[model samples]
Target: MTYLVNDSADFVDESIEGFVAANADLVRRVHGGVVRATRTPPGQVAVVIGGGSGHYPAFAGLVGQGLAHGAAMGNIFASPSAQQIYSVARAAASDAGVLLSFGNYAGDVLNFGIAEERLKADGIPCRCFAVTDDVCSGPADKAGERRGIAGDLTVFRAAALAAAEGKSLDAVHDFASHANDRTRSFGVAFSGCTLPGASEPLFTVPESRMGVGMGIHGEQGIEEVDMPRADDLADMLVDRLLGERPNDNQRAASPRVGVMLNGLGSVKYEELFVLYRRVSQRLEQAGLTVVQPEVGELVTSFEMAGVSLTLFWLDDALEAAWTAPATTPAYRRGGVPLEGEPRDADDFAAIHEQAAPPSSEASRSDAAGVLAVIEAIQARIEAEADDLGKLDAISGDGDHGIGMTTGTRAALAAARRAVEKGCGAGTVLTRAGDAWANEAGGTSGALWGLGLRCVGTAIGDSDSVAAAAVVQGIRDATDAIMRLGGADIGDKTMLDAMQPFANALAEQVEAGTCLREAWRHAAKHSEQAAAATAALKPRKGRAKNHSEKSVGHADPGAVSFAMIVASTATTLESIHEDVT
Candidate 1:
């Protein structure tokens, strides 16, 4: 469906490239994403908002005066890597601090949270606020767990306005959180969206039917009903959002509200205006005074034939912030007085990589085995990529397979480069992990990347990797995943398979088994653990919203982890033969 793409994997990058070129006066390219062309006043809180790349205007388009200072763009429907977020934040942070805001998605939260910690360690004040505005993602009591949709515009604007007003980092963060609390959104889709180079849509709706409560990603709606006319659909969205209005707006005689009727990609502005006509009439009848309501595509999902409506209940402070002047390439308001000069060429800095550590001869020999294992993993992922995508499509955005392939390919290339540099197994793995995380850009990518880094840390470059070291590395990697991802054994994530594999490998190694035999034994347990996920409901990630849909299917992440371990076991067998 994406007719203009050269390669599916390069779509996001190419799009960002062209976007920066077109809006050179408004924005400039950065290592991870984009920043304002002009400099910000020193010591002012910088607002950096981002998520995946499919949503246009949302992240990159919102970067300008009185808006986001920068954005960290990710792969298609994937969250940006922690390194990407960190890079963007570092570029955007002023003397005061940096405030990171994004939609409430698993990968975004994990990656951004990690970036926040990294920034803090660098002595930069940083805080993260995840926008949870979709009313359909969860019940009112669990609103904090809801996914963010088009309502991101309201929250991002509020936070950016506070930052533009020279508020402290704490004040900017509070304003963002308050804006999130007061916002609610609901959406419906007539059809699903297709990723670049994909033959089919992510999900489909029957003719004359509409999917209710659709997500911005390729996630299917929670429910479906017969399609209705424009006015009827408007009523549905308005009534749903009004039912979940913030508590403070419930008793107001005439509450003023900010409205956003966002078209998800393909929906035309004419159609949106028709829908907003009824939406406005209904709000007026409900005794709510509408403020400057936005009626267009603020956030999109490629070419999804859907639309979402957001209601931002405005307090006096919120209204002032909402009405503030803003100048961006996509979204513009009243003209803003420019005080800052044009950005100089030297303002952009390159992201530098550390040199690989030295390795002993024995450790370098071990590095060859690591490279072989990574090659085997990549081959296995390439073979099973389609099936993995199908499994993920049951409950998720269905990009896991593509992400794995991208990450593994990057990992293999990085491992080869490290080996050529005479690095040890640990350094090779560490570089590979960094490459994977930097390229993949998703929840699975972040977890696997950090997990590999942890394993590499446990196995130092200076020494030969022994069975005991391997066991310790697995244990450390498992623990790191649990800590970073916040998922346990039964969460239906990669941890389900990885944790079992780690435990089994440790038991076998402690029982005096050789590394190759122990790994083979652990692989079986991982296979069984991955399959066992079919009986459990997902308690985390985007899949949680559609848990019932995935009841009979194994988790894609768990299955992929098991497959990787099994493939690595075969590589270990080959290594054993060579050593013997």
Candidate 2:
């Protein structure tokens, strides 16, 4: 449990501040994350790695002379926003190119992919390679569907080495992709990691049981089994990893591989030592030549009592890269010549500011109503937070409720502030969206942010809001969500409820129905759609790995969407009556 924090809300930000202070010589602070303190050689490929904040050395500690050029840190257990990633990338970008690497999680994919797009559009050469290495997350045929875990370090190290070799962007990307393909990992957890401020753990394992195939984010495991001895545990890790060796590596009679026995968090070096001993003996017996073996915490999950084993089946290039000289705050090998004094924390290479869009008094009048609707949703989400979190924990990390509540509360506050400032409807929503995205920090947060921003775009400030405009706004929000999140209506996400709501709203508005009546009708579709998602399987995100476990539960995102829209319909009806 994370018991030593001052405030749960302040933990991540405060920790980041302390990290930069402690590693002043190795890294400097950018708005989103940290970059190397020393200047990158001109035309060097800046390898940027990142994800959520809790994992220590795997991300920020890897940013130095030889590993990642920078890292885009997000909230604890949440992926960074696109803005955050873009900011870090801009800080780290050089004339050569930018290579963005992160684990293959839904929020990380959306945020990092968005950053890549923006970087390219800005005329900076950039590419992203998401690491997929956890063998338990998917079958060999669907390897890309696996979540990246401890094996992320191997992929990042190999990519950074290729970049250090001054390889072209294409070459670096290919190197990282190959490293990801050849790598495999499996983990077991004795206990769930408790997030900051939470009294109880996310989930619990029986006192004598262990969770097998667990994720880094406190996600549900594939199965539970009686706890075994250290040697037995080592065997479990090695056998599972060895069973899924890359198809290309089958040709080698004795394949050379990189091995990592990683402690997830609270597990000490003494315990890890016990596990790694047998791991080494068994691999050699299985005709595998273990190259440089790492037996310590490489990636962690916020004090989780767990460990994961990673194997990177190495080719010639991978072996050379794996043994390359590197220097970082947490992990280091060989020597790097000192250039000069490290850069100041306040020093920045590039910074960009976005201005608010224009709004008129007419739309500003409508914003008051928007604020009321948002407040209604916020209250509803607050009421159902525990239930939503429980549902999400069945397959996901159980943060959906917390993330949604944080986002809605932030949105509500922002909307209220905008109303006080006499902002237009579009401006109110735009500010609210930005606040939610910034505060919540997750896949759902990003999608909701996009949805609100697109809605604001369609409902411009100059014009008085009309039925057609409202319908257009709803359609635009739906389209933006689909474009950004890559989820179809049947994917058991917010889109499951959103699409039905949009269709019903548009159809009713077109039929000359009153706005309140139309919204009520549309809300019913959303509620029904949300309920129907219980029978469907999750096709994307972290939940996909434990899809079977969530069979009889409604999607948290879908449920939240339905509940919010239903409440909003009631608010609209109240507003209509008041206006009448």
Candidate 3:
């Protein structure tokens, strides 16, 4: 269990603040995350890598000379927001362009992909690459769908090294992609990790047993087995990786490989060294030359009793990058040559809120209604946060409850501020959406943010809100979510409820039902749809990695969506009753 924390909600922010203060010489705090203390040289590609917090040295710790130019930090076990990624990239990019790299998780893919689009729209060159290197997550034929684990170290190093060598953006991206293709990792956990202020760990393993194919984000392992001796575990890991050797390296003359025996938080360095001794022997017996094998913590979960072994099949270029000098807060190679001057104090950009658009008296009245509904949603989420988190833990990283609570709280605050400014319902929702995305920073956050924005745009600031307008807004939001999330109605996601709710509302509105009556009917459809998800297997997100475990459990996202819509229906009915 995490022992040192003051207000679990403020944990990530406080940790980042303290980390920057401790490593001020190498890293500087930016609006969204951290960047190298020194500026990037002109005409050199800037490599930015990131994901959720809690994976210590992987992100912030790797931002310095000969490594990542910056890192966009996110909430624990969540992806950084698109705005966060964009801010970090803008702060780090040079004339050559920027290369964004991260794990191939669903949240990371969506957020980083959006950031890449934004960079291009602003006339800044950018390319994003998702590292898929964990063999346990997918089959060899579908390697592109695998999750990235400790093997991310190899890909990040390749891109950063190429950038440091003054390579162009394309070249840096290619190097990173190549490294990702050659890298393969497998992990195991003896026990799960507990989040800050949580009463229990995310998952538990049987005594004298180990969970195999575990993820770094507090997800339960795919399989369970009796714990093995140190040497036996080493043999098992080495043999598994050897079976996954890149096709090109299968017959190479004196093939070289870079190894990283990464500890996933609480595992001691002494234990790793003991395991590495046997790993080294096995590699030598296989006639493979190991180059600069790293044996310690690199990418870690918060105090997870787990370890992962990454085998980076090295070619000439990869080997050179592997051996290149690097200097960062937590990692360093040989001596590194300093090139650029210290970063300018004025480089960190400040965010300012935009003025609210003018609104009519009738529109202001509608805004009040919007605020009331958001307040109800926030309360419902807070009341059900623990249950939602436990439900998600069956197959996911168990951060859904935290994400929903944070997003809704921020959205509610933004809505209230907008109401004070006399904004219309549409403008209020737009501001709320922005706040939700910026604070929550994950797949659900991005989806809810986008959906809210779409609905707001569809329902313009008119004198009165009509049932037809509400139905249209629901349809627009549902469409946008489906497009962005790449999930269909039966994917065991929030869409399972959202689609049915939208359809039911549209039908009732077309039948001339009152807005309150239509909404109440729609809420029932959503609730029923959410409940139906228990019989379906998840086909997206972290839960997809353990589809079997997800059976008989509704998606946390679907349940939360149902809860919000149901509560909003009550709020609408109460408002109508008070007006009458």
- Per-model TM-score versus the true fold: 0.92, 0.88, 0.89
Worst 10 residues of 1 by lDDT: 571-580
Error of 2 at 239 (Å): 3.0
**Residue 420, candidate 2: C-alpha displacement in angstroms:** 5.8
Off by over 4 Å in 3: 165-168, 249-251, 357-365, 390-399, 422-424, 460-476, 506-521, 545-553, 570-580
Kindly state the number of residue pairs that clash in model 2.
0
RMSD of each: 2.9, 3.6, 3.5
Number of clashes recorded per candidate: 0, 0, 0
lDDT of 1 by residue, 1-580 (tens): 6788799867888999999999998898887799888777787888998998888887899999878899998887788998888888888787888999998888998888778877998999999999999988888999988899988888988998888878899999999999999999999888877888899886777898888987877555678899999999989988998898888634466799999999998899999999999999999999999999999999998888999999999988889878889998899999986646677777775654456677777778888988999999999999999999989988886778989999999999999999998888888888888789879988988887887787887776877777787788889878867876778988899999998899999999889888899999999999999999999999988788789999989999999999999999988843322221
Model 3 clash count equals 0
lDDT of 3 by residue, 461-538 (tens): 755555666677788888767765678977899999999999999998788788798889989999999999999999
Misplaced by over 4 Å in model 2 are: 95-97, 120-123, 249-254, 338-369, 390-397, 416-424, 460-470, 511-517, 541-553, 570-580
